[model samples]
Target chain A: MNAALSWLESLLVLAGLLSPLMLPMLYFLLYRPKRRDGLASPIDSLDARAARPSFFQRWHCGLKVACLLATCFLFISPRGLAVCLADVAIALLATALSRPSWRRVLARLAAMSGFLTMLLLMLPFSGAVQAGEPTYSLAFLPDSLPLRLSGLGAATLIILKATAVALLMEPMLSTATLADTLHGFRQLGVPASLTQMLLLCHRYIFVFQHEAARMWRGMRLRGFVAGANAASLFAIGNFLGMLFVRSFERTQRVYEAMLCRGFTGEMPRAAAPPMTARDALKALFWLALAVSPLVTEMYFADFMRFLGE
Target chain B: MHISDGVLPISVSVAAYVAAGAGVAVSLRFLRPEDLPKIAVVTSAFFVASLISVPMGPTSVHLLLPGIVGILLGPAAFLSIAVGLILQCFLFQFGGITALGVNALMMGVPALVCAGLFRWLQNGDRRRAMCSGALVGGLGTALAACFLALFLATAGENFFAAAKLALVAHAPVVILEAVVTAAMTGFLFRVKPELLCLPPRSKWRGKGDCSL
Candidate 1:
């Protein structure tokens, strides 16, 4: 069962940790969300426009992506090397289709290679033991070392997997997941009020994050630091105080706004992304792919028994 | 405080899944159509009033504001906590899958109680209520620990030994958390009393009009 999970979980953790990097990559590669979406979007809809890269853009994107994939493969060590190869194929296809300048491609490729070499040399992920030995360690990191190649490999893989999960799965899952959760509550006969409360709370979270950021920044400019004692302490107290007052006032405004718009008990809806056969098939395919590693481990790979414990 | 997937027993996990549903059911009845705006407002209040974390040994634990939620929103706090927990889990993995329900209950039920306490303390110096909140917060943590201990105990675990180890180890951590919670709540009272509820119709008005 861990076959898919091992990779997926690690990937998610990686994505969560390296969100800053993965977010930009995802933005470049995927469909850009826009102002029109805001009517339906619960979060703030700022101009999420990205300056489109030109012909060179595609190649550079592809090249950079391939390099990321290489690093990811070197780290996660997905049970079947096939997935890594598939990613490589995808990267190559993307690069080919993108058709960047050859000179730039060569340079980027060299840079990619150099990055991996430096990562490999500077970070340790290698060890004396053979693969599938049931090495019980955090990503099988050893007791003593500057940087274990195996550990580095595992760490990188974990992060890469997270990025992949975040990029590939997040958009599809978020709304559906929210809906599913709401659906589950409704089925249980949870009151609409409670359900609505849940939804509103979720909606307001973005507002909190946004406001908190702005408030914190304003506070900082006015001399608020989390660590400093006298100045920082007083500033934090004042900043927090102001944040409270502002938050209180903001909610009232937001509430009044919602009321004016006829926010009934039900959450506003647009057409949900339709569930399709492709989605079903893809889901099944992924399940099988993820499960395969566990099946393999059942027979030839007792390695995890030692490794997991 | 968020326990991970493999941390709890199968029974505990299963029971929690069921209980999480039950918690939702219990709170659902009081919600009204007009409540949406207030829900929005209170929720907005929750977002701010909730932050201002207190520093503990290595980590910082903030005010859960469970009591405030319980008082204002009532059982709706269950859903609020649920949504908040889900976001926190997805965004930061603060509390992993297995511990999600327990974590929710730990923070949720207390807020439910805090709502009641809010009424009790509204009149006399409201600042003291924050102190009560700070203290009761520890009770919530203790209850969570006990539930977790019971979970391990029923599974043939050395619950006492484990509790001793965990509680002893985490005592300073807990107090540090409590102190910070208290201090932050204190700040909330002085700063954003509106977050707890609406600002008095006028802040400058005398205390006679400030009655809860």
Candidate 2:
């Protein structure tokens, strides 16, 4: 009964610390600005969303930043694997609830699985060989298991932590549009110029993607197929070089256009309203909640020790 | 080539950010105000470049093009790479938010190195420039693999095998990158040789024009 009570208490402490990190994400999901259809450009739609902000949308950026900060802190703390795993499970549940086009996450995971598999396979055999340590061998031959079971445990720990963070990123980022996130960064004092540069880069990526696709189709028309040979490589080289040349020319034209339009160095953004008292109070509450994990880790451990004594 | 988040300890992550920050600072110092748009455009190209894959067999592999960025952008390659990586993180979730600095370093440092090497060796010699391009591409991938291994090894003894595996898996990629970079360099040599030259740092501040 006592053990169950202690476990329940510890779980509660974790929940208290974790709730602040999670509530904002939930709030953003619930109160995210409704998208207005019939917008010609996605950028225009993003602007429309900003024009009619919800209560939670106003502070979503700060909330995400706070949650991520807390998550990072938790990751860094000397918590046990079980606790960390539990936190990761919570994050995974949140991500699933957010309902992103999850194929992206799956694809990324597919890419990462190779590395993770390598860790899983090799870590077991790489551990230091010690006398009287638990060892297993492949086949009947006496092959030394230099990999201690403890090493495998550590590898699992790192993998779980990494996977958890990666899974959590989708929901954390997906709920807010990229523009809003950048704006939030600006609110957090990231330079306006940098955000502007990022926005420009983001916009042009689609432009170049289309250009490259068109060029690729042109190549297909010319009967070019990728092959493992010098000639194919040369063809690819020409294609890339041509792409760069076109992109360079476009840059010059873009520069000229910007200058013609009175391209001052400043990036134009809609002014955000100043933070209110309620915003501060809510932020403080979340901030306190975020810190609770560290506090609990420090004090709860001692409390358990005291009880034992 | 992107290091996922939570793989790095906070201290290592912080250190990488510091190092990458220093690189960005140097890049910004050399960047011209007028060239900001060019940088943005090239940043987009770098981001999009990853999507263009070449079929090798049943599967396809994309170009990293750190060498190409280096050959083209010179000192500013780091900033371009940083922008590309940030976009990839936000849009594609290619790398994690916290690992941004480390991932940038893994790609950007190699780009800067290749840029310097290509400049030192190209010297208006077409044959030599192509060779240098191949060297830069191959060596850049190799070095990135090394960095990845070193970072993984920091986790402890258990990761040693994993590190080795990472490097080994990249061997074919290194050769393929060398071939592609060489091909691109050769094409540039015949077409637009001037693109091989680094842009003037800042028109008002730098000594010469952006030409070979």
Candidate 3:
């Protein structure tokens, strides 16, 4: 009776320890939110937000890309947890200022969760243990699978840094229309041809997506089901082949139409608004914000020495 | 597996950007004026096709199709892939902005090599062409997995296990891509032999049919 009670108590303790990790999975499986079709097109949301007179939206798109991207790169290799946390705080502030829908932010986080989960699962157990690093090995588990504290800290740092940058992407790119953003890239010395291709590709992505969806519906109506089998793969291949054939045909028609409209290999550039002093000041502000974490980590090293602790 | 930002060391990321820029410049050199819109439209199709998920035992994996893209686009494959990746980064955040260059090289370099391999190996015979497609398809994914592992391993010693796991995880995907690409190539060979004969530009003029 005593052994059984101890075993039950230990199981409960294990369950309590694991419950937090399982929360996300449980939320996804049980309380999955209804899909909002309105958020389906990222372009529509960008366009809607582009009309707003926000601080970021008012900034020159070219300068915005340059400054924000510089900041993001600065966030890449943070030396300490304090720096990582500071970057995350800055990112969250940027997200709040940008006013991107919470759903969109959450969606981006969800998209990266798989990779992050993999890192979290593997890193602690498999990371190399330095001579004096603390490690925990379960009684039943092999000694080879010791969980290192340093690995957990490394994983935490990576997750924080990555989340910061991911959150910052919205404020950087989505503040303006994608066209304006691509044009901004062009202004920053991106090849006109590449930008033009990106523009065209972006436009057609929605159309082709619709066509593919329609085709998928048709296939489903005919009792087609995807499975882990040779037949299913062949069906999918044929489906892809058909999509290619149709797109190829559509490409010819579209190009001919563009030729009729006198598209002489270049998209006509619209006159860009001149950069203002305000834009430069805003850029400087962002650059300073981007550099602060590094500044703190470097010059004030004693205060941020907790990483080693 | 697109590398998220902050995962790669900054130096590795910057170097990748430079190399990818060089690759895009070389690809652009081969591109003709009229081929621009055509490639753009085809890239959209490839982008959409990639969104389709195929079920594996307990999970599903989306098609990467770098080999198929290489087979279809030829010399222009790198540019097309970079464009698709940019859209993906902005729209879906499959990859982060800082890591875009590494991601491009990860997918695009394999595509260029596969294009070359497919061209060299394929003959007029449909069966031979299909087999070549299968070989290139598997090799494309295998090479991409290697690049991903290499990139991850560069981060630090701590990432080596994750890198190895990434390589192992792609094994199933490599097989799936091979079979799907082979089937697609066979279908294209039977239905539209011209597409397989030459790159997108020559096919526009309705020339270069393989006489199937």
Best by lDDT: 3
lDDT of 3 by residue, B1-212 (tens): 89987788889999999999999988787778788888898898998888777888988888899999889888788988998998888777788888999999999999989988988886467888889989988999999999999999998888999999999999999999999999999999888877775543432345653211
Which scores greater on lDDT, model 1 or model 3? 3
Residue A222 in candidate 2, Cα distance off native in Å: 2.0
Q: List residue ranges in candidate 3 displaced over 4 A.
A: A1-48, A301-309, B198-206, B209-212
Question: What docking grade does candidate 2 earn?
Answer: acceptable
In candidate 2, list every pair of residues with a backbone clash.
Answer: none
After superposition, the stretches of candidate 2 with alpha carbons farther than 4 Å from their true spots are: A1-63, A93-99, A103-111, A130-133, A138-142, A145-147, A288-298, A301-309, B198-212
Q: Tell me, by TM-score, which candidate is best.
A: 3
lDDT (10s digit) by residue, model 1, range B21-80: 678565544555665545554555555445455444355445454544554454466666
> Model 2 chain B, TM?
0.90
Docking class of 3: medium
| Rank order (by lDDT, best first) | 3, 2, 1
Better of 2 and 3 by TM-score: 3
- Give candidate 1's iRMS in Å, 1 decimal: 10.9
Task: Give candidate 1 regions above 4 Å deviation.
Answer: A1-199, A221-242, A273-309, B40-75, B121-123, B141-170, B173-212
DockQ of each: 0.18, 0.46, 0.59
The model with the greater lDDT, 1 or 2, is: 2
**What is the DockQ ranking, best to worst?**
3, 2, 1
